[model samples]
Target: MTVATDTLQAVEAVFAERIEAATALGGSWALFDRDGVVASGGAGIASLDPARPAPGPDTLFRIASCTKSFTAAALLLLRDRGLLDLDATARSFVPEFVPEIPGDLEVDPTVRMLMTMSGGLPTDDPWADREESMTREEFSATLAAGIRCASVPGTGFEYSNLGYAVLGQIIERVSGVAFTDFVTHEFIEPLGLDMRFELSAEEAVPYATGHRRVEGNGWLALPFTGPGVFSAIGGLFASVTSLAAWGSWLAEASTGAERGPLSAASRREMQQLMRVAPKRHTPPALPGAPTPPSPVVYGYGFGLFVEFDDRFGAIVSHSGGYPGFSAHMRWHAASGLGVVAFENATYARVSQGAELALAIVLDAADRVAPVSPSPAPWPATLEASVALSGLVNDWSDVAASAVLATNVGLDVPYDERRATIEAAWAAVGGRTAASRTPVDAECDSPDHLVWFLPGATGRLRVEVRMTPLAEPLAQTFLVKVESPEPSVA
Candidate 1:
């Protein structure tokens, strides 16, 4: 078996140190595996009040645009329920999002465009954050006045809070329930998440005041804003504990290990790349860490964006920022490990800290000696080929040619293959029988099954490729034997 990373301790240490170096007011962090939470804790204060305790696992922080994924999922759940069409334009439901510019109408800006952030609306984080508490009337008025389009609806990547706000509006109109109510009931409740769009005192988590690092004035405390039109854009309030749970669930979804409320299929669909985020940059490698050299390009899904590394693979995640808080979460789909971090400092870029910590953790994981991954089920076609291998021992015109493609027989003429096998048998002094373990399912060849068998003296490698014909034939066949050095007479 492969060595377990047991990376919880290392991940936590790096996470805490990163937060300390970032000089944020205070922060919390957690690490998780696909099955469940691995480790969770927080450093720094949750509230400035002396009477209040330091931030703990349950302390609440505004998750900001991380809420977008929930909004996107909510939309998908609506689709799953047949309440809305992803291809339908926002005008069909809300009837208030007036598109100001008309272009070559190949694909209209539908719910899909909004979910993918490809609606051509200009990147409006600054404007959107402040409007988190906008009333429905105000939002309607703003949209009705006509929306600006930076490019044709489906042509470019522009992160727009307006698009999500419109989606929230559509959810409201179609479901006949407020966005917060419907979301809390349908999505949050099912996931067992203690997430909220509004923070209050009576709940388990005490509200951590957001602090702004002023140019010369030091830290200025900021209050949490409440529900409004754009609330769907960045209105989630949760703890690292809860966020870790969220990340863990999503990682499981990625591998179809766990499905709750949202089917594994739908969850996987939500994490798919819909648009490339051009502005994302390669996060600086962690200090003194052996990071795999991989290009970092931000690609958006429903509400998620993954940064794919060539050697390591996809890290699915999203970051959040509000006036007084910053948060981020990342999980490896296959590995099911992730990091979630939250800070009570405005624009502190906590996302980078989470990213750096994950890199360090993953680098550590890479050094681990890997246990052979479990194989997928052996296909029946491949099983038949293995059975055909029995006939190879007594090859004749009909026996070899029946299962073998004409080209395969030509490549290594029956005579050449027969001679190769006989030579190995001669070295062993007898034709030693071969035995094979179960076929490795991780074989990546789309049309071939490749495996090795432990023989009496050495090993035998078997490879069979499928042909393009009605009856399956071995397009290519290989049998290689590496005999141990001949025993001294």
Candidate 2:
């Protein structure tokens, strides 16, 4: 797969844009093109000491849930050996892995469901106490027993970390090895990833420290961990260079140029759309704004999010965050334009940075060649709509409140604040008219839409900033929603 120089230059511009955007938000990032690191930016939180220097291609950052794709790929490797069946029930291998529901509610969720996150298992609450202390087995069992099915088995999409955790268990059962060990033995060693699930003190010295912000003060380092517990869900640490090598392999596997560890057919299957998850339900604070979903639909084959740009006629690829770190890898199979971003921040910061990086890449790609039409839109689901609406509402409230408190007087009552904000928005131009220009746009997920708003000087600006819930809560940009146009008919 060859990328033209012009296309590569556009990608470089995008990378530079993201680096600037990320630094403004006080984060650090590294980006890679097919050949290698084209550009890098922001030592911000990643560097506490100015003299220490910024992260480079070899600097390691935790890949977080991006690990799930590798885990899913490993499972496919097992499938290649006929060691396990994708269609088999969870109970087939781990007999004790039964869903702990009432007699009438018993549904034998298949391994496919787990792989696609449609396993009908309870979505794990990252904040829950159950997650903190439970062993992997106990955690899986608890979720299986307690999860309520929102839809029939393998029906609707619900993002479930628990489901992937179960997948780790399946890999263990089939490979006769622990999940991490399987990854190490099969993929890491074969590819020579030069990465590991955990770092020793010596290794840690050179690695970027994950950070979160303190409410009143500055950034602080986050607690560190090895990939012992979250091996299947959110683990794995590597440099951008090594990850680009992995991405190049994926591009080859997807395009039939090179046979990956899995067969080409299996790789294609992994990239096919499995189920459409609900959209982010939080609304934009301003009227007529568009709120993007997490992923319009998820593809089981690749074990990652696939966004379709009808205008671009391409599949936008993705994978993302966990507690202590975040990462993103995207490639347009048709164009051979790819971007890989790695950050050592919490989930939100990484996600924001990833989205920005994606926008930068897509903008560059568009400049190189007139982007082809996007693939057909996947079927929308009620679940997705609900999720999207909720996100819009949340975003709307937050934005409105911020505007009222900062731009207007701070002592306004809740109802009055909303009314004032709405009135202010109406005065600006009303929801029916276009008021703001999109500085940048990218498909963040299969159906999720992301755009950037520019400040007066024409620099891209983020709408909302978030601090992690934990101590040393890192500050990162949050998703910004655009107002929708009123119907003309």
Candidate 3:
């Protein structure tokens, strides 16, 4: 699917505004679909001291917690190789994981719980962010000493960098390799991505210098953390283009067959809602104002976020924030359309910009043409719709029988059903050539269709569902006459 050029320009406008509003040293963004990154742009400068120019799509920036998704995927790959079990306790591999819990609790959290952020560990942000360089021995000793739990194992939602740190140890024990090496060898290399655990001085690539505002005075460049046990929690650096490509691959899992490094099924599992997060407060309704759109429901998956919106369906996303870097990647699952953005500023909240840009793209797409519920309707279903259209234009018992399933006549007698059809069609100006032709036809699935038939006084809305037999027939039909709006004098 392709976004319109005007929509792409609107996306660039959002990032331009975001750079200034978020006070980032540099920012880059890209629009992606199932195909790949279709449009990209950047604003501001990469570094203030060195005085570099604005980063393009290929510039690298620390994607903090976004690295958790990679960590999760690596574990899934190990599972696929029959080397691990998600249901097993973390202690199964890392015997050092003996965190303190309430007296009544009987078991440690499972691997899945940790992956879903429901492992009951406290929500540690900047605190854990500073622990990125903790040595393996130090992490093991910390775990053996029994850290406190915010909730009982497998009981609640609490973001835990420590829990993920344990996951890194599991990968190490199972794969007999460093956490970063496993991710690099399994995912990054297989996908041909240029992402790295740390920015290398040897490589000739443009790297953004992360910064933070100091007491409303000016931006301060922050030092980069080296990789260690907590690297699994968040360590990888990526570019807008490469990250957008990665987001596209994950979003397309539902559209096609599985690809290796990670199966499509497993990729989709990473995006599913594993634990429901707490709801955000909504403002009160106003008297004479339009109803607010449905509130978005947030949930955590395997290192990813699953959000539900009444207007846009399921959205999969994740945001990362470290001392001086912010990153976000979000995609509409239904359309396989998304946005990935990066900003070299602490807690910049670039997600707000990405969300707005995607909304603008989706709205423009609807105006262009109705978004199909799936790729395309089945050929036989399309043929059945044509036959039904002919039946509407001129009623025929044999033609109706051929087009519809046997249940159609049994549910409602032919005479009664025929009368309903004729009356509805006549209300829409008695089926002129234009009135008989279907318009704006779309499918909920390959076997179900909805369309509009225009008329002078009204329009007829038609809907049909096909049976699940080898040779499917329309098992259900609905016809409604929608009257035209009254003209103002």
Candidate 4:
């Protein structure tokens, strides 16, 4: 579906405003759907020292922890090959991951636990951010020296960069290649994505430089870290075009679109909620500020955040933050619309801008067309509704039995059910059954339906749900009078 030109401009404006509001040197954004990038633009400068313009679609930016999803996918590929079991102990591959949990529990975390961020390790961010340059041997020795965990293994959500780093080691042990090489060969190359751990100094001449704000010194350019053992946690540098492509491909898992390196099922699995994240308390709203948005509950999937919204369905997203860069990628599962954004500044919180940009497109789409398709009633369920209408009109025990399941009669005897239906019709000013058939039918699921029968004074609301059998029978049936609105008087 084509988004309006005005809507695209509104999207670009979001990022342009963010660069100034968030105090970042420069930033870029892209709006994408299942087809491809719908619109993209950049704002401010890419680097302050060199004074380069804002990054274009192909300009590289460090994605930080967004690389976790890639690390998780590699393990999934190995699992599909029967080379590793998700339930297997982490020590099965790397014996150095003997974490010291509270109460000195003997329970060890499985690879799946780490993937879901439920390995009981404490939230390690800025600390792990600087560990990028540590060599593989140093990482292994650090792990062997005894890593501390905050809670029991597999008990709850704890954002652990250490846990994912262990997964990278596991990948190297099983694939017989470095973690970076495995991801490059298996995912990046196969999918034709332009992503890497680091770019050469000459190659990065035009790349966006990472930065931090110094009180007296404006924006200070930070040096980039080289790839090492911790690269598995948050080490990849990617362009907005590449990041959008990766996110859109994962969103297509629901539609079972073109086959890629990962199977559609495995990709879908990556977006499924595995553990509920801790709730965050919000401060009281100020007098003149806009009302707070509906509460969003978050859960951890394979390597992504699954947010459940009241208006929209499941939304998958992940944010990345390092010393000098911040990034975010998010997509609505039902609509397949998404946004990718990056800022070359520390703790920029560019996600706020991306969220606003996405909300605009989704609201626009909802006005033009349904963001998600509504489910239709099954053919058998429609037939059953017709039969039910006839039974209500004629009141034959045999006819009612044919339309309903045996449990319907056992739960509420047929005699009482018929009496209820007759009383409801009488209240609607109908002595005899109305000639009108069912109208305004709607379905929440294929097996369930709600419709109305017009009466003289009011209408009778009928709701029915079918059994789950080859030849389904009406398992739930209800009829009640819905009176017209009361007069203003």
RMSD of each: 5.9, 18.2, 5.7, 3.7
lDDT of 2 at 309: 43
lDDT by residue for model 4 (107-179), tens: 8999999999999899989899999888988998999999998999999999999999999999999999999
Model 1, residue 467: C-alpha shift (Å): 6.4
lDDT of 2: 0.55
Model 1 agreement with the true structure over 1-489: per-residue lDDT tens digits: 122455555556655776577567788887777766666777777766777778777788899988888888888888999988999987888777767655644445788998899987788888889998899999888888877777788777888888999998988998899999888898788889878888766555566779888898777888778898787898888888888887787778856665677777778888887899874655565566544335456689999986676666677889898898999998776687788988888877887778777776666665773312333523644764565556434456677776777887677777777777556545444334554352342355446676655545655556677766666667777666643543111
| TM match of model 3 to true structure | 0.79
Q: Could you give me the TM-score of model 4 versus the true structure?
A: 0.93
How far residue 84's Cα lies from its native spot in candidate 2, in Å, is 0.6
Ranking by lDDT: 4, 3, 1, 2
Better by lDDT, candidate 3 or 1: 3
User: What TM-score goes with each of the models?
Assistant: 0.80, 0.64, 0.79, 0.93
